[model samples]
Target chain A: MTSETPAALAKAAERPRPALSMSTGRAGDRIFAGLSRGSGLVILAIMAAIAVFLVWKAIPALQDDKANFLTSQEWNPDGAPAKFGIAQLVFGTLMTSVLALVMAVPVAVGIALFITYYAPRRLAGVMAYLVDLLAAVPSIVYGLWGLNFLVTKMTGVSGFLNSYFGWIPLFGGSETGGRTILTAAIVLAIMILPIISAITREVFVQVPHAHVEAALALGATRWEMIRMSVLPFGRSGMVSAAMLGLGRALGETIAVAMVLSTTAGIDWHILKDGGNTFAANIANTFAMSGPTGRSALIASGLVLFVITLLVNVGARAVVARRKEFS
Target chain B: MAKRIEVSGLHAYYGGTHAIEDISMTIEPRSVTAFIGPSGCGKSTFLRTLNRMHEVIPGARVEGKVMLDDEDLYDSSVDPVAVRRVVGMVFQRPNPFPTMSIYDNVAAGLKLNGVRGKRRLDEIVEESLRGANLWNEVKDRLGKPGAGLSGGQQQRLCIARAIAVQPQVLLMDEPCSALDPISTLAIEDLIGKLKSQYTIVIVTHNMQQAARVSDRTAFFNIAGTGKPGKLIEIDDTSKIFTNPEQKGTEDYITGRFG
Candidate 1:
């Protein structure tokens, strides 16, 4: 009987069984799968349509341009020759965003660490809510606040930088008014701070408990534990967070328009006035420009879109590479 | 060098929930002492209290007097970080810092404690890995990420990391529970070797492991669910296995009940 049992089990194992269907499963499962797939395709379709639209509109403005579209510092798309370029706008966008990133990343990481490791439970919850609340505040309100309040307060700070650090080229030049690239960058830093910290806090919170205990058991102090465990684990996350903040800073429109005094050329002296970003330029000029000028604005918009896309892609690559080891 | 541990009237709690009742015992220097208990009986918690690691959990606190030879571990003047340096730990699951290389994982404690000089770090890393019985297997790939190692190797790497700082006491909370039988045997052998240099306190649910490795054995048990865990008896490994004084301890060792 025992010998026959093996053969019987073998026969049972070899017998054909009904296949478990996915698409042909219950009606609910099929409907859910279709809805999810349709949602994903809709997003892809919308992204493609936007890209096509930007390219179609930008081509006409490029054809009508008299000056080098990429290199020229002038913006005169409505002129008889319709000469215009994005050099100044590109420079401003990159400069302000990079500056904001440099200023905000350290503070954001500090705040994240504070929220995760240092604060009392009640205080941590309140602080986290407040940071998220900062992100939800309207950009126009920030623009108005920057123009009416923050700009007035930045004069002393700019003066301090210009005087003490005047030998440094970026901090040189005696432009008196507070409406400068530095001020705009500061505003952008404040605007992006919450988002960077929020994402960084989430990443730090997800650091494996075992890894943390390992560090602590190694006799690591609070700061050392953060340096050894938290920071290394969250390195890629912090990079992505900074990149996201950079994207926001680059595309910020009404705030930069309201805060910055736009000009036609790049200004190396960030402490001085006169820098304009692509979004700020477009927001300030789209209504005043003719049809060709509107196309020119869209062309600049296309450049901004491409730059943001590249930044996001680069961030994803960095995160994906680090995910293997982590 | 190993230091004797004297724990007296230790009681631990997490928030309002009492986890472990008053427990007292002396752990000898340069010997293996195993804590055996059922699940949720606080054998692990009692081990953590030896190194003041029990309080790492939020809302978890301990009231106890743990003395490492002449020094009281919970003294107001003693920093927990300093205590941990003197008393290291190895967890159940291997946790070699995922971002660090094997060499860095071993040298992490030394580097963080401000020990400079590449030659010194290299010497210590080699010594620690050799002490943990993992040097030959991992010597060629010291620069590789620690997480890439097999499970048993990773646990040994964690042991190497724990010993790199030359802690006086080593706490193992079910260190071999996650390994295969062969890996478990390897760790058991390593534990036998390690006890000669450091005071080893291990918590295990496996009775055979306790009998094989420990010089003395402690059994902890709870009255029932929601009741605090208590140390039922502690004695030489031979006596505890052959003839325990407490009925509960005998019943436990005989596998009559948990």
Candidate 2:
């Protein structure tokens, strides 16, 4: 009777099931799958909530009389009429990120390769463990260190660059010293180095030992093996590593706030003087704002949120491809 | 034809484990030397020592002299890199570089040793593929990824990559253990051809492969070995297989012990 009723039972079971719980699988398995899928929905809901809250809070400033929401740069969101434009703030965000990437990418890739290959085997392992430890170090500590030691040391570096390559506008090499985009970028490089290096090292180490051996058997030297086999094998990993590092550098608030002197302007000379960043502006002025000012600042946060989200998506895509090689 | 690889008082240790002990044998330079022993009897360890690959692992050390025409390989001042460049190796599994094209795989050794001219690299790649007898099947697909090749082709490509360096000695560690019989035959034929220009030392667990390819066979044994592995006998391959000098060797080759 059981065998004869198999098809009938299957047909009966094909009826639309309830989403809550009507399955043969354990509560744990079903719960895990549900949680994994539902986590995305949860994140989307939170993001939507934040956006709605921001728009509601920003309503007065968005409808203000002196200027539209995004056109003016005066940033007096609560002085009688209350006016501000994000051109300068947007410019600062783009400049700081661009400067950070230029400074960080090469050093990160180099450190990753060196940590993976050149450091003595025992030393390399220890160094890698330490870099991973560095990733866990609080952002505030890095800010404190950058403010105290990095700024002072960077002043001397600015003077030296002024003596050497002052003609290049990016390094106008001005004695205004190094608290500028250039110095902030250097500090950001140090912070991001550990991240990119750790990922690249992990990826390089995973390069099939067989390929490294094949290269060695082919008379390739250690360096040559890394260049031809390990580096190429980990190319996608390196790109994702760079993008992850850029994401961190873009969103870093405390360190950039502490290190950069808050001046407002768009100067192409990265070494000219300290400049404001979106994160720095938020951290610096949150205490002095009224309701309208608070809403304007929150809108700035929205910009940073969108920027970081894009960086994260790009990094995830690169990482997705990196996994394909395995 | 530079047909001798002399080993004297060879002892190897994996950080005091005493893996290979007091092993001494002279292998035919242009003929295959098969070291047949039980699983733990140091056959692979002994093979690696021939090319200084034994030292790749941390704390793995060898205390003995292996010579190719009187140059001491383990001498304190001798560079293992130079020794390896002269004595190439093929591991048990095929390990073609996944990132490179088939042409690049064959040309890797030449380019790394400062052979940079495009013309020369191109020529050597073709020569090596032909030498390993893989050129016919892969000649049309030299630009394709090397990892795309079939298992047999990949192993052959590895062989091509090894011999590309033009080493005087070839050390293979169970080269066919990871391949099908058809690929094994292809490698065997390539090995026969390689013997003209290279001295060959191979370690194998397959008794039939030993009988089929090698000219000299060295039988390793552990005698009540809470001790180290020691060489039991070394002789012409036919003699060792047909009538080994040691009873242990006889038992082992006749499908008795391992």
Candidate 3:
């Protein structure tokens, strides 16, 4: 009987089963797949349309402007010559966003680690919810709070830094007004904190138990474990989170405009109270200007759009470069 | 430099659930001891309690007296990190720090112990790979990521990493359960050679494997679901297989019952 069972089992194994061909996908399945693909293409089409419209509107402003658009610092689109440039606006946008990222990333990562590794289980949930609440606050509300409360409160601190560190180029100028680029960057930093921390917290939580145990088994202390296993594994994640925060800081309109009192030119020192980003400039001037002035604002908006795109693409390239081991 | 271990009145718990109860044994230096039990029988838990690795889980605690030569391992003053440095571990599935190269994986523990010179690290990394019997296949490619190795080679790399620090005791929790038969035989052979240098304690489910590699065998069993695991018998491998003192051990060995 055992011999017969072996022979029968061999015969059964040798028999071919039915082939699973593409014909198995019914018409309904194909239709659903097509719908998903169509949706993705539609999003691309919308993005292309917006790009085309921005470029169309920006060309007339470039033709009318007498000043060099790339190098000139003055923006007087309402004048007969319609002189304008993006140099100062570019500097303001990059400086404010970069400064905010420098201040926010370290604190965000610290808060994320504390919530993930150190806090008690019940308290961690509460802390995470509080961070989410920070993200939920309206930008207008933050603008009001920054303009009324934080700028006034920061006057003493700004004056103190200018006095002690004035020899440093970035902190060189005297602080005549409290509403400066420094205060605007502080407000932007506070705005982006929740997003970076929330994303970083999720990334830290996803570190594998096996890797953690591997570090612990190697006799690593708690801080050493974080440095060895947690940080390296979450490097790309933290970078992406920081990039997302940067994207927000770059395009924030009401908050930067409400806090920063713009002057005519760019200053090397951030404590001197005069800077204007593309988003804030458009919001502050678009409604009251003539057609050429409005087109100039759109031209600046186009520049901001391109800068953000380059930043995101650069971040992706960085992530791709480090993908070999991960 | 292996040291003997004496464990008495060891009780382990997860939250309020008692996992192992009243376990007592003396593990000899420079020998292989095997822990065999069914699933959920707490053999793995008992193995973890030896090196204090079990307490990493939240709410997991132990009440015990574990002496390494003269010092109590469970004393409040004895740092768990320090204990782990003295007692190394190899896990069931090979984990070789996915982001590190093969050389870095082996040298990681040594570096943590403050060995900084390049020449010394090179000497120790080569020595450890040779000890794990993985030198010939991987010496030319030490710069490669550790995760790129085959399963058997990766497991050996983990062994090399664990022994790089030259700890006194080596704890393995089902080290061969994830390998094929040929890889299993290779690891079994390596264990035989390693017994001369390190005190080895291993938890396994395969009775034949335990009989082959271990000098002494410990059998654990539970009365019913949710009951704490208890040690049924511990004796020489030959005696445990041929003439057990307990009926529970006899039944488990003979495939009569778990």
Candidate 4:
């Protein structure tokens, strides 16, 4: 019986195995792989196409301009001798986005921490739902609200800052109306808050259960546990979230256009009226612009696109560097 | 600074579900007491209750009394954080803070207790790492992340982190269950060495492990699914393994049934 069993086992081992094939033998597998690879290439193609189009459309206005397209503060592209530059637009975009980031990141992180750690379970669920719902509110609606409600209410805030903090160069302007860069920045901050908090909350929630328990087991108070484990683990995530918020603020058009009374020059005094970002300028001028003006706006749009891309790439690099340690 | 543990008429629950019921035991100072049970027996839950870690889970609660050398651990005046400081825990899996260096991992608990000065932290971190039998392997790369270590090394690093706070008791909830055989042997040896200075309670599924390390052994069992687990018997390790007074303990020891 043993000899017969050994012969049968040897015969079984010699049989050709159909399951060992690793190739994509089935039609479904080949089609799915091809489709996924095609989708990835399509994204790359679309990105390149947009860049090519922007550069192609922008060159004519840039060549015809009398002033330096980069350094000149003038924005009269349709004149007999066209004049335009991105300096003022660049300054406004950076100032408002950076200001918004400074104002929003702390409050967003605070709200995230409170929802994840401090709130009761039911309240946390409700709060998280509300924050997500806030993100779904349309940008145009935010613009309308900023123009009618927020701008009117912000005069007192602008006055207070001018009264007490006017010594700081950024606040030294004499403008007392609500339609200043500060008001626009405040609206931008509010616009980006939901997204920043949502992402920060997800990062906080993804902090490993073991790490949290390790802190608590070591006798750490709740606050200490958060500081030691939660914050350090979520640091890179929070930075990326803030970077994403910055990207949104930089490109935000309608709200900034509605809030800020436009001017074509750089102003460090954020409390003063009159600043124009690339997106706001494009939105405000696109309808009235002649062909040269439209091309000029497209040129500025290209720069804004590049800046946002750089910001996102920088965020990815920061996240990747921290990934090694974690 | 080992302290005796006296648990009396203890019951634990998870929301509406009773987990462990009426477990009473005395664990001597400077010795190891092991809890041996099948899956779903609530042995881990009972061990967590010793340090108030059970209540950390939302809706989980405990009833009755646990005294650490005449001090009621569950007393309203006693903060759970303070209780945990005195009774440190090692989990089933290795959990060194992934963001921290090996040196910082060992110093973590000490930092929480407000220990300052670089020299002092360095001294204690080295001492604790040596105590966990991990100093030699990691001494040269102390600045490296703790998560970069092997599973066994990470577990020992967690042990070092726990003991750095100078706890009176150490509770291990199946500390070596996730480890390879070699790592398991190393942890068992470390557990044997640790019992000279800290009261230790270990929950293990391995019967031979229970026989090898424990001074006293406990047998826990449940009647059925959804039923609260109960302690079957507790006695000297030799007696429990050879001639248990309870029928269920004997059946479990002899592999008749869980």
Find the candidate with the highest TM-score and give its number.
1
Can you list each candidate's DockQ? 0.80, 0.46, 0.75, 0.82
lDDT of 4 by residue, A136-177 (tens): 888888889988998888888788988999999888877777
Q: Candidate 4: global Cα-lDDT?
A: 0.93
True contacts kept of each: 0.90, 0.62, 0.74, 0.90
Please list all clashing residue pairs in model 3, or write none if there are none: none
Summed backbone clashes in each candidate are 0, 3, 0, 0
Candidate 4 CAPRI grade = high
lDDT of 3 at B172: 95
Task: Provide the DockQ value for model 2.
Answer: 0.46
Deviation from native of the Cα of residue B39 in model 2, angstroms: 1.7
For each candidate in turn, the TM-score is 0.95, 0.89, 0.93, 0.94
- Stretches of candidate 4 above 4 Å error? A1-25, A320-326
TM-score of chain B of each: 0.99, 0.96, 0.99, 0.99
Total backbone collisions, model 3: 0
Model 1 chain A: which ten-residue window has the lowest total lDDT?
A17-26
How far residue A277's Cα lies from its native spot in candidate 1, in Å, is: 0.6
Give per-residue CA lDDT, model 2, range A71-181, as digits (tens).
555677777787776766777667777777777777767777887667767887787888788888888898888889988888888777777878877767444575877
Task: Please rank every candidate by lDDT, starting with the best.
Answer: 4, 1, 3, 2
Kindly list the per-residue Cα lDDT of model 3 for residues A145-231, writing each as its tens digit. Answer: 999998888777778888888888888875546688888999999999999999899989999898888889989998888987899
- Which regions of candidate 2 fall more than 4 Å away from where they truly are? A1-41, A51-74, A79-83, A105-122, A173-175, B1-3, B223-227
